[model samples]
Target chain A: MTQASPEQLAAWIQRMAAQDERAFAEFYDATSASVFGLLVRILKDRTQAEEVAQEVYLQLWRKAGSFDPERGSPWSWVVVMARSRAIDATRSDRSYGSALSDLEARPTAQPLGNPTPRPDRAADLSEQRELVQGAMESLTEPQRETIQAAFFEGWSHREIAKRTGVPLGTVKGRVRGALATLENVLRPQLGEQSMGGD
Target chain B: MEADRFQELCEEFLLSGLEGEELRAFREELDRRGAEGGRILDRTMEAMGLLALSAPPVDPPPALRERLMAEVGAGTERRGESAEGSGAGSTPTGPSLVEDAPAEPASAGAARRDPSGPGHERPDIGHSRLDRPSPADAPYPWVRSILLAAAIVAAVVLGAWNVNLQSDLSERTAALEEAQQELEAVDTLRQELATLREDLGTIVSPTGSVISLTGTETRPDARARVFVDPQTGRALILAFDLPILTAESLYQLWAIRDGEPFSVGTFTATEEGPARLELDSLDPVAGADLLAVTIEPAPGQPAPTGEMVLISGQ
Candidate 1:
């Protein structure tokens, strides 16, 4: 879990765009766990998650040329793509209503249960988790819940309001407030330098 | 919109919650501000992406990497073959004049001595193979003329053959790509069919309880069934003869436990008249008394927010 500098990762991605197989292998090794973990949380079915994860990496290979460093870091690009795929899978499932109900049953404070971490990367991942967790602590319980539903559960403001019995305006307000607070707290600790490509 | 409103939309855009007119407006505003606004949006997206990393990382199965690499290798090989085939047609291949000519030094001296002599024609011959050679000193002039004519015809034929081969190779490459896409589609369908077969086997097992639900007064033609394995809490819904729903609405199933309704799943009927729905994770059948279906708004409601269309006889 020793992170590559953003510039180094960007260089690898550029090489991948040129169909460099070794560079792609390196990129996959660096980011697959993060992508897979996010998919498992979003999809909730390990088999489906694995399938989607495979598709995500395959897509990264084909669409590497479309990656723009000016837009975001390579890690951000891959994570966003993984999230989009997982969300699409959930939406297309006929049993998605059941998944939503199961999600509602969980406490909003912990939308997803902690996944079992790989022993080799546990220390680095734990440190990263704590940084986020500490930033999240600054929000009110309601704000945290709203942000969790929006981020992890992929709920729209209207859906969050309907599920939590909060007013739509209230849910929107909490989301806005929570995002501002998170950016303020996280920006200093996880500054722009580590991310690279402005 | 005001600056504050645009900023709020940026957050919503990052979360993918913005849509329709608001989404359009946000894009326009970003365009209005150009690079500065885009940079801000990119920064927000990067931060949000990092935030997602807070989730504990789970190791994917080692086999996935091997499978992906194998697929990528295959793709790369196909690309390499296409490139090589196309390269053969475009590659420059004639013998260089400087390498072939025996009187290079003399020609160089002659060109330097006379500003415009037979040297000018020699340069033209170098540029275009079709250009006639200078009638300087050769043993049999007519013999040389015939040889040059034959060489020109050979060059024309060779160039035409290369162009034709390039065209054929391009068409073959396109066909291969299309066939590859078709094979991928077939593979996807096979996987879906396998999953359905597995579900069917479980539903027909002796441990499974079959509950038939008939349509209510609202839609008497509709019918459905729930197959539940009490021990495993696995359930599947098979709906038939149901009316197609409008885009704004869908059919939802609810599991009733102690008079409280919990959503089991949602589905819409196809034109062919059947829909298969799998419950995410079923509650123990022993704890539930009935299963019911209702027509609710699209995305479904937390509770039954519409008319109950079908219910189990229980």
Candidate 2:
């Protein structure tokens, strides 16, 4: 899977809005790995992830016109869509929700299991990973855990509060605080780049 | 809503955490703020998207891409052939985007890439919640005093609530489940009401453009009306007396701008009543010269490639 710049990805999506098959292929190649990776991480089951990935791509193909560049980068739009679908899948999977609710009895979140870490081949992506990882490290442990649980485990703010024995409002505060720190740390990089990878 | 509280909900929304009544509240606050709220959401989403990149990348199975491409390719061909069969002469191939008034030219290539372009410009929208230091972060003397007072009051209230919460957890959980079910039903009604309200707004707004789409030679009884809000660049279509589609096909809406047809989206007509489709991003319609609808293969084609059942202005 090759990476394309945000501009290139956005342009491909524009072509896709016009039903350009070749551009669709290019967009898929450029972003499918990241999308699939996020789905796998959130869903924990590879098979389910693959199914959702297929659905996400098909939605992307049909709804490319919905990609409003002014809203955010094409990559972010894709990631948000993929994550939302994966989270929805998790919510609908009764067993998963039950297990999560059951596990909330304990203070710790139930681990999502180990992900097969494919080494970052793209230098730019590695740099981004490092920047984000470093910024994540800067967060207080509670804030980090809360944000990660929400982002990766698809836990709601209320769910996270229940799981961690924290108040609902505090969970909201931690997530917001973490986001503020990330925005601050990533400000320069975000300003310089096109809001996504190449 | 207070700025800090609203900002917290916005962040939760980005994380997919807002739901039920809270979700409705967040949306209401956003609606109240209008465009500024929208900008806040965009920025917050972009910020949240950054975290996704930190996930370790993994390449998908090669078969996945192949399967996707195969389906896409087949859909294109099927739609193209269907178009030719209809004597439309247009294919489900090539760029159907308006050449002169290209839909959002910034999306095509250059403008977004340019650091100096308007695409990159971050407007200082009064108070910046996402990037700039928020009030909670850098509060004024008076604001800080008020926040301090609020925190003390909240602490007292929470202390009292905690004791009751401990005893009420079991009962509360059951009540919560029942409330969730109720909220789900209410959410559905809310969504329908919202759509109707939006359509009504477009009908009454002075800037709204309502175009009547008349049935073509094949189906003279088929008809539709398009309600377009130029300000939001959203188009709502209400079609009536149209032949309902089969399981294998759908009705695709198209926006014709400068003689070029862009697929707005696809939907199926109901057998008993009019079918409605509310498009979120038919931005080109503000400048669109015409609106058309066609019957296309199931799952929708990127371009229109079926018999034109309805066309604007006869």
Candidate 3:
């Protein structure tokens, strides 16, 4: 739950790249917690999560120089790094099918056309399922299911189409449309991300 | 006009499955449009975000701090001055919080007696005149002798250190000079490769062959791959999963020419870390030839003596 200010952490990382240990420690302290949280969520298993989190930090250490402030916030970059590693884990775990299915089954209760609930205005995240359920309910049932399937199930457009018996193009369109809907619904509550760079 | 055309990229963009010119084109267009471009790209990213919706936030092990610090500390100590103790050491306050840590290995050395305890924070300038020994206070003659021996050892180490540092500085300066030269050579090489990739990217040829090069017995995890453009006498060596070589070792690429191997070039992979290497303009040999890589001593020897790390069948 400890959040790092991306810009400050990024400055520390620059020094870390030059092999400044104290700065490295500072960077690790600030972001590793959030990154670990992200990996644990994606990987599900504690042991695997810890392994992947270690890999993530090692990667962060190695790739610190390549961290582009302009591309995305450091927190988002770290989260994305954790997710990519977790996705790799899922593929290797071989039980990915069941995991993907369960993720797809996650309910988003938000109604159609409602902008995403802002991260804060959306209220407490302790009940993420309930919050997601509410926002999901806001969607048209078809869009809701499609978004969930594509994202949570890790289904490609073709896979989603095949399962739902919709055209691939149509399935793809719905996924993007649903996400645009989520951002709009959630943006107000999340604050406009400040987006912070050129 | 390109906006609508670019907008058609919705599906591909969301999946991040774009490659070659198309992906580059999208990036260029994104740069041109700025915030609007970000918004356009947002829809794709949002869908991707949903892929992991319930992916619970996993907290990293608390001990990761110690590991990261230790690893980072080693590299930092070798490369730059540490910031922890210096900031407080310069002050009359004597030592900083980090100095108070009796656990560090550096503090155990006789070259430095860590006056880091909170009790030692006040300036000890007066201790310069303190008597060298007292029987009651000294207590352990063995311990005192050990401390004296340690001081002698420390002096010897300090003398060696000054010499070692001078040599290290020279070596670093030489390495820097060599790195600059190598950078120019590699940049030229990459430019050559980039041009070939640009042309090769254009062809949707069915005849082009893709080959996976597995590492030989020497380094099992070391792998290299290729997409050969037969018509152009070119091959893009997309090296993957290969460990980055140390400065003493460099990766050498070989092209099989007329039943024997020939050295095409010697180089190191991207310092930015591995992705893919596009080794363009390679001499095209005929079917079932051996294209190989060997680890060679740095500045690359005339022929590799180090093991053939990886190989592929043509």
- Supply DockQ values for each candidate: 0.16, 0.16, 0.11
Q: Tell me candidate 2's interface RMSD.
A: 15.1
lDDT by residue (tens digit), candidate 3, B63-84: 7667666655554453334545
Instruction: Count clashes in each candidate, considering only residues at least 3 apart in sequence or on different chains.
Output: 0, 3, 36
Candidate 1 residue-wise lDDT, A1-198, digit = tens? 425555566778899888898998988887778788888887888899899998888878877876665455667677677777777677754332332222224333321211222112122333555677787876667778887787777787667755776545456556765655565455446553332213
> Compared with the true structure, what per-residue lDDT tens digits does model 1 show for residues B1-314?
44445556766666644544565687677667655455455555666676677666788999999998887886777556546665544532211211122323435433333356432433323446666556775567999879989999999999999999999999999998778668756644554565566567658878888889998997788888878765545577789888776544677788788899866656677764367665424542346688789987643555687999899873
lDDT of each: 0.65, 0.67, 0.53
Worst 10 residues of 1 chain A by lDDT: A113-122
Candidate 2 clashing pairs, residues 3+ apart or interchain? A3-A198, A4-A198, A5-A198
- The total of clashing pairs for model 3 equals 36
Off by over 4 Å in 2: A93-127, A192-198, B88-314
Sort order, lDDT high to low: 2, 1, 3
Error of 1 at A177 (Å): 2.4
True lDDT of residue B242, candidate 3: 63
